[model samples]
Target chain A: MSTTVVNTGTEGKTWGGGNEPLKASYGKMMMWFFIVSDALTFSGFLAAYGFSRFKFIESWPIADEVFTHVPFLHGQELPMIYVAFMTFILIMSSVTMVLAVDAGHKMNKTKVTWYMFLTIIGGLIFVGSQAWEWATFIKGDYGAVQTKGGNILQFVDTDGHRVALGDFVVAEHKDRTAHERKNGLWFVDEGTLPTYTVDEVIKGLESHENVLVRTQIINEEGEKTVLSRAESLKQIKENGKAVVEGANLYVNEYGSPLFADFFFFITGFHGFHVFSGVVINIIIFFNVILGTYEKRKSYEMVEKVGLYWHFVDLVWVFVFTFFYLV
Target chain B: MGHEHKLEILRGLIKFKSNTQKIWGVLILLSIVTAVEVVLGIYKPEALMTQVLSMKLLNWIFIILTIVKAYYITWDFMHMRDETKALRRMVVWTAVFLICYLVFILLQEGGYIEGVYSSGFVKRDF
Candidate 1:
């Protein structure tokens, strides 16, 4: 509300001093401002993600295919199951937060403490689940090829199942220098490696008569660029490995490496927020147990935390829709 | 200093009335709207789909419904509905402007980056 200029030509005054723009409680008003700024930050991240998805509109990886892992259900494809669980947990925590605030109103210390504890536990569970989701995404599954045309061609079986590059690729024509005890000019020692090098796969393909190179795109109809059985065998030999490393933001065998980069950065940033929220919730949980707010004669602190908690849930709603559902 | 008045006021505010029941009715209606959004999100309709939207029409449904849910959250759950007009305007307007600003800028820049990436200059050796 605007204040009319008085006889003294003064505006509304805050408790501490005059001329404060916002005429509200210091902490509460500040919290609203902070939420506003934070919401923008999240929007920026999501917008970047949208841009990338638009760029690779034709060949972007499907969200369901990428995030199909479920907890304790090993090898089962459970698309968005984990994230859905996290959403439910956060929503339940919001309910607990409201209960704690209600208990605070009645001055019921035991109920407040218990409700706060439940909310804290819910937050922790959500953070842990998110961490697991991140781990699965970072590790990746069913690699693809980065073509010279900047398109990603992923391998799939005749049945339309995603085939690991390791399953179908065979390498041919690998050229490696003989291990010289020392190089004449560079005098550098051979770099040690963990597994067989790409050169080895190539060499192995060259020496072996059974493998061949198969190159073509697999369409959504579960059809591949057709090849005879003999040709398929020949292609496998030249390809060396059935699977090739796929792209992530760090490294992706996809269109632009930016896809993985945005995935990690945007989702990682949101995950960081959830993590911090949990820590703050833990502090509040301890305070509730200690009866700190009980002595203060108000459960307003719980309500404030509840506001923050719900904000996180609100953000996730958008994230899930944009990232997965879309 | 005014303990009697304070207690009476608190009691009055917390009391259940037909008015409170109406509010609950409104909440249920909002919840139904949310449910419809969820259903549309899950079952994407082919006929309603449009690529220009950058997402499925079903997804647009979800987004619109989510905004509605957000409105109820701030208005009813957070008690913004009862606040003075100035306070309500400050809260809603600030969020609306910033969110729109961020969305516009990010999408434009992101599209630019995507164009650069699609070009042959950068090799994606995934």
Candidate 2:
């Protein structure tokens, strides 16, 4: 098989004519096109995110406030630190990938293998970090009150401090025992979990006395009064139980169910991209170890992935600016 | 003739490197502008906040700064600046016209949605 080399120095070299950038073969050109299209796909996602923010102009949840948790530090509010670390990891991986490509240019096999290995590890760590972040977000904090009108009301006294549902849960109810997974009636034979039903939380809300529907206003500590202790207890009482199962999407003890939805959708989409990127990097990494590109006397494969890694970093820069900063 | 053509191509690549440096400088400037935007957004000045501009003075500043960054990213990082004039214009114009159209449609529709919410179609509490 013939390899194509493309060089920025050559101009007016038609498709079939000789002298392309880096002597890039057809595969490399196709990869470039793929990267461009993929870049556009990411831009479309970000623009849609921007459109939604514009749609909910006044009441959008502040991204910085929502994503304040950092790994390795429990109970400490670290803003943008985790995402910044992720950004650094991605950027550094790009650097390693680029170096590997440079070594490939000089036909240095050892350097290529070493740098490719580092880049793959970087990608794996990034994907793992993202998984941890998703877990934390899915298991939410400081839940909200659902109003009859489908509005989520979070609570705060005049002081504006987020009062936990536990603090206000003065009355208690006996929670029902869960049905075994096999014993439960299966509509289509799906497994069941031993968790409180949504009905229970609704009944508990009805039974509670002191709970008030909270709003998305800032409490004294200047946090979202999305859900208060009193309101959550009330929800459980109304539902005739103590626990609420399922995602706290709409009107959960958080003030805006839309906030959760957007959070899950946007970040989930980005996380999916990161996951796919890592998987692709893994394939390339294995190929590098197997000396596939080394046989060709070029590591343009690494360069191509480097471009993708940098593109991901570039998108994150905007995401951080808009989501975390703005 | 071949050697002269090769020299010309090498010179072009060299020139492109200097242009890239300029783009990097612009990126640094844009970074500073972004930081300013964050600060303004966080501690929104009362004057700017209360007497909003036609498109929000603060928001306009952010959009302009962001556009500047986008322009440089397209031109330098994507190397459109070094391409044939037709190629350069094709990419830039496409992005410009499309982004404008998207923003216009979105804002107009969004305003209508806000109107419906205010009119009690979707009741909101302040």
- Per-prediction share of native contacts kept: 0.34, 0.08
Q: Name model 1 segments beyond 4 Å from true.
A: A1-24, A148-151, A166-248, A253-256, B1-43, B52-55, B109-126
Candidate 2 global Cα RMSD: 7.5
The iRMS of model 1 comes to 4.3
lDDT of 1 by residue, A101-150 (tens): 65666778898889888887888888788778777665656555434444
- For every candidate, C-alpha RMSD to the true structure in Å: 7.9, 7.5
TM-score of 2: 0.70
How large an RMSD does model 1 have?
Answer: 7.9
CA lDDT, candidate 1, residue A305: 74
- Lowest summed lDDT window (length 10), candidate 2 chain A: A239-248
Where is the poorest 10-residue window by lDDT in model 1 chain A? A191-200
Candidate 2 residue-wise lDDT, A171-225, digit = tens: 3343544455566765435323323343543444455444454455444433455
Alpha-carbon error at A172 in model 2, in Å?
Answer: 2.0
CA shift of A178, model 1, Å = 18
